[model samples]
Target: MTQLTQNNGQIKNNYCVIDLETTGLDNLTDAIIEIAVIKFDLDGISETYQSFVNPGREIPPFISDLTGIFDKDVLVAPEFNSIIPKLKEFIGDSILIGHNVGFDVGFLREFGFNFEGTIFDTLDLSYVIHPTQLDYSLTGLSLF
Candidate 1:
């Protein structure tokens, strides 16, 4: 990893930006159907990992419509447990950056992965930076 000094003089390189598509909105019950992680360093993207996760249950129709990740799409994919090790290694000592990151962190904790690092939430930051914006969602910010 290419180390770079932050404004505070902390040496760091990896910033793992993650996103997950789940079976539902309830973190306690829903399972992750898809996960994507992109590791960025000073030079740019150092690694990328993505996979369909077999949630072990049928994906609700509405979710399928939203994500295009149907039950059939993940039926042959690896389970969450199978990807934990690789996911951990990919995120090693990296700060996490995401939109609505608490939702993702909740699901990850439910899956037994303990994340102990700095988190940068774009959603919260957007609200502060663009207080008058009608929407602070990822799509909304992207459109702006």
Candidate 2:
């Protein structure tokens, strides 16, 4: 584990960043259509994994517009089940980090990817790092 300075103090960390593009906001009803995960050491992205998942449903128009991932794009792609083994291997013993991690974690949990590692939400972290900033979105943080 690597020690990263947390708000309280230094924390031992084994970090991986995850970002999932889903069909919608409701985890109970929506599904993941694209997944991106990258393992990071102090240097940076040492390993990466990404895939388009077939959600078994139409990619909603707005979602397609936003993601540029239409139904046709994933028609022949493997679904979530096939992706799990590799994902588990890549994420072993690593803390998860993301811009809004809860949303990704919720969707992933619903699909049975039981990740029992520490989760660090950058949005939450931003509150401690840039407390006075008006926007905490990734783009906003980038502009700082």
Candidate 3:
């Protein structure tokens, strides 16, 4: 994994902010059950994409309760592969930005998605720029 520190490494267009809620936190053992993408084109136009997927595995009751995404809700929904094209379109040439975002990128890599360009990790930047803060979670940052 290469850290994109050079000025040349920054993305020049198509910025995207992505978030996912999964059945489990473990990247290897879990799958994305829901995803939300906020896309911003170079011209400052923005769009949004979201989907709920039926992970073949059963979701823990606790997670289902928290997300309100029961098995029945996604039983007939499209799988990740079905939505890859739209995702690719939404992510075109954009730097992916998210809070604690590596797992999402890792999962995309595991699924054979070729993600090039830069990644601006809000969590990492927040930690570095705001070292006095005690929490870096999305909710935590929002409260700051």
Candidate 4:
């Protein structure tokens, strides 16, 4: 990994990191099971929001195993649409940053998020910073 000083890094002071745990990969077919957003800057995290969404369908065993979020966990939770207002309010106009932002944004778009903010993908940044690494997944990078 390349060393990056605070003054030399490409960190965004006006950004909100977004992530979504969905029922599956297909944005057209699957539903968002969970949502998390963090509003932060150089100082630290200013705000954070997370919620489990009722997908109105079964949570596949594979996804449950991977995310550790099962159907029972979200049974009494609010639906995706119900939390859009709060989610948008928290995100505001900040740039979006995520590991695979496109995938998260694609899923958001399906739920009518229609976000127009700029996006930064940490996965792509990982490839540029550590091109020789065998894995680029979030967990893989952490362990490496």
Candidate 5:
């Protein structure tokens, strides 16, 4: 477990930065194809939770190219409902952070997890902290 500053600067304990790759952009229409969560200590990535999900929908061609995940690849994987318990266990009481956390958080919430924790958006934060910088994508930030 680790701690980080929240959106309001209050100390948030047990920080977990999460990311999700899905069938499509819409959480209502699509499903989580792959999920990655890396727990962070003060120094960096401490623990991780990553899995492929069988979305039960045909993977769109564009998405397959984007994430390198094909429908056949996850055909044998667990469904979203089946994996919620494990996801919850991994995220227990961690303050969640991500590039566009709402997307990942929204997906989790749709699967019936309350997801009670402080959320900090590095994307939104970057806009405030360094508006002059062009790209604030998670990969871009990692490069810097």
Candidate 6:
């Protein structure tokens, strides 16, 4: 387990940044199609994992267009069940950081992964730190 620390109010190390590309927004109805995780420490990224998951359903046209991940792309990819163990191993007990972490956490919970570690949400933090900003979406924040 990696320990989380702060130096002069700045995050030090031992965090996992995760992102998921899903078929839709509804966690109960949608499915995860692609997932990526990068574990980083003070030195730099220590581990990285990424994979496309077969959602067992057709990817909606809008989602396919936005993500460039069509049904055909994941036709032979591993299922979510098969990916869970590896994901759990990669995350371990590191603090999780994501754009809108609650959404990701909801999807993971629906798939039966109980992530007990701390989570840092860039979306929520951005709202607090940049209250006047017009957008808090990941892309918006990135551009800002």
TM-score of each: 0.91, 0.88, 0.85, 0.88, 0.85, 0.90
Cα shift from native, residue 125, model 1 (Å): 0.8
- Give per-residue CA lDDT, model 5, range 18-128, as digits (tens): 888988888788888888888876667778898898988899999999999998889998988888898888888778888888988898787666688788888898889
lDDT, candidates in the order shown: 0.89, 0.88, 0.79, 0.87, 0.83, 0.88
Measured with C-alpha atoms, the lDDT of residue 63 in candidate 4 is 99
Candidate with best lDDT: 1
Q: List, residue by residue over 1-144, the lDDT tens digit for candidate 6.
A: 445554335444588999999999998999999999999987889999999999999999999999999999999999998988999999986889999999999998897788887888888889999998997887788788
Candidate 4: worst-modelled 10 consecutive residues by lDDT: 1-10
Model 5 root mean square deviation, Cα atoms? 2.9
Tens-digit lDDT string for candidate 4 (1-144): 222223335544667888899999999999999999998866778899999999999999999999999999999999988998998899886778899899999999998888876777999999999999998999899988
In candidate 1, what are the lDDT values of residues 1-144, reduced to their tens digit? 545445577987779999999999898889999999999987899899999999999999999999999888999999988899989889988888899999999898898777888778889989899989997888888888
Model 1 scores worst on lDDT over the 10 consecutive residues at: 1-10
- For TM-score, the strongest prediction is 1
RMSD, every candidate, angstroms: 2.7, 3.0, 4.0, 4.3, 2.9, 3.7
- For candidate 2, write residues 1-144 as lDDT tens digits: 446654555564458889999999999999999999988887777899999999999999999999999999899989998899999999997778898899999998999898887788989989999989998888889999
Candidate 6 has its poorest 10 consecutive residues by lDDT at 1-10
Clashing pairs in 3: none
Q: How many angstroms is residue 34 displaced in model 4 relative to the true structure, after the best TM-score fit?
A: 0.6
Model 2 misplaced stretches (Cα beyond 4 Å):
5-13
Against the hidden true structure, what lDDT does model 3 obtain? 0.79
Candidate 1 Cα misplacement greater than 4 A, ranges: 1-9
